[model samples]
Target: MTVKPADRDFDALFADPSTRARAARGVSIRLSGLTRRFGELEVLRGIDLDIAAGRFVAIVGRSGCGKSTLLRLLSGLDRPSGGELAFGAGEDDDVVPRLMFQEPRLLPWARVVDNVAVGLGRDRDAPDGRLRVASALAAVGLAEKAEAWPAVLSGGQKQRVALARALVSRPRFLALDEPLGALDALTRIGMQSLLERVWLAQGFTAVLVTHDVGEAIALADRVVMIEEGRVALDVAVDLPRPRRRGSAEAARLEAEILRHLVHEEPPDVGWVI
Candidate 1:
């Protein structure tokens, strides 16, 4: 059965851990009394987050804090054993969101355009499909590489192509799972600017998971520190866009965020400062 993109015709279902069901709608996301355990290891405990539409949030925590797991759950890549995640939708919701990861994940055999269109409409000539691939590549300044193969592109370029794929659908919610961590420091900054520009233009809700405090402060409007499998600290970056990491004010803010992340928190978020 084909699910049309609208209300009334769709009824959401919730299955704990295993069964598949229709996904939830709206910008509102609820994680009520959530907990996750891997055999004997508990990764998350009683985490609650309510992010409104159009908000840009970041999750930063030490390694093994379950940030990736949380991202997977939200992206429909994994099932939550305890909590339920639900998003709200407005009238005439746009295309479904796509998840971008640390790896570019392009098809080695396909051209750049085809790789970006992997999950898009089946027909290459379809208006929406063609337009989306072109626009996504153009947005990332990669229209010239439309015919190139992924093997020929550099690490940064490959990441950009991955970014294009994620944006091709114009997802209302963009979940970035350490997509920039693999790049060198210099390339990382450039990609950050490109991401910022795209977010401003598209106005989608973005949730970024980063290990770098400086990256979080530079990229997110609000940064939340996940500790002991829970969100322990949430800080809002009052500075405007085009933030410079070298500026004294920005540096101070980053230091403060780092301090809060490492010493004051537990093994989840603050364990590493």
Candidate 2:
């Protein structure tokens, strides 16, 4: 059997004993009185949140609730208008956070492997860059498409390539801005599972901004609801992994979050586990 480049790279990554221990540890995030404003339009107001290392937290809310703004701040794509945002100690300061959006944003002219290699930035020419890119493609189950063009891939496949690009550098923090919102319902669910699986394997601090309450409940370690530019509710998921989509517990949590979104008030049912 012919071993493809991706297969070879994937094997090489695991062949090294140090590779198992080389996964970057997730970073702890602290947001103290974080604020953001566009001229007079205040988006995030006096927000304070602390995410423990390796925690998967989902932010959900109605439109214009500043969830995306908060995500951008966390990813360092945008600066806080006031207050402080800090990452925890003990990790390499040079490792920047990665962000994925609803759009794949792949380069049309580039092959899948090359697009993924874009994540390496200045290190794209490093001797092991090809190995890193191929490993990431395998991680996202797209090893076979390594030489394909982005234009030829399906929507889900494009997103997978985008995800591989984000993962290639082993970022300590990842901010997702409704990345699966553009996919079909079935595809979205599959991508969600892929996301959870990769997150568990990579141990990156993940902050997902999504409007789907069920998605938040199903994937997040905790669910935070933002309302009127502030955090209205912070609830722990406290559910086992590989959660059943339509289970009674999932339905209940979904309804509770929806109720809060509709009423613009926190649910009084002790939903904050």
Candidate 3:
């Protein structure tokens, strides 16, 4: 098994039993016959999905394929026009799902610490608010930049701050809307490792929406491709963790997914993996 950057960090962070117990357990999600419509346009016809707790699931599809729309529904940013959407097992009404977008969307005037503290909403002024903010920043490896302004940070650093803001709330379910799509190639890869590590440490259920099939296979336990407003393909990634991007297995899975996305009729292509 390959050792991921996250593995070392996870071992160090969860060494203490008490600290490990405090980590949030992911909330399972169930969507049955879910439908969403914007006037005459139906973005999602009927999405039926069951995401296990703590599982990293990726949604992939072409543009306007309702991938982001489904994510929005999962994050509770939008409601389904018809059908049922439920969060189950180990979750309650108090669990608020967090969302990270393509852009950092930080407050330009606020300092980094203050920007992260905003995630706490009403509790930001609480006695432990600053401490929580500090911890979140440290988790994203941005402890030294806490006092700096958003304008001073690089693109990747800005995204880190955004991630810190989302994590500061200790959310059980995280919806990532192409959070690394704006970063450069190398920076995006680094951010992916950071994200995997954070998700492991926090034990949050993550749903990522992206156009990259390779990214989906690399990061998610399962890849779901949406087409014509429905799930056209759903396949598990059984490869060992700390998945190698250019490995034979990775390339094979990517090729399989690409065939679907492009509507190619490869004779042997199937959704078995």
Per-residue lDDT over 102-175 for candidate 2, one digit per residue giving the tens place of the 0 to 100 score = 79999999999999999987788899999889888887778889999998999999998999999888888899
Which residue pairs show collisions in model 1? 25-87, 25-88, 26-87, 26-88, 26-89, 27-88, 227-269, 261-270
- Best of the two (1, 3) by lDDT: 3
**Per-model TM values vs. the true structure:** 0.82, 0.87, 0.88
Total clashing pairs for each candidate: 8, 0, 0
Candidate 3 residue 204 C-alpha distance from true site, Å: 0.4
- C-alpha local distance difference test of each model: 0.74, 0.83, 0.83
Write down the lDDT that model 2 would get: 0.83
Local accuracy of candidate 3 as per-residue lDDT tens digits, 18-52 = 43442337778889999999999999999999998
Candidate 2, residue 88: the lDDT equals 79
| Candidate 1 Cα deviation (angstroms), residue 24 | 16
Best by TM-score: 3
Error of 1 at 111 (Å): 0.7
Query: What would the per-residue lDDT of candidate 1 be over residues 1-273, giving only the tens digit for each residue?
Result: 111232121111111122121122214455776777788888888789887665678899888888988888777787777876667743454435568898888889999999889856344566778777876777777778999999999899899999888877656688899999889878888888778767665667788999988888888888988888998888888887767667777788788888776674564644432
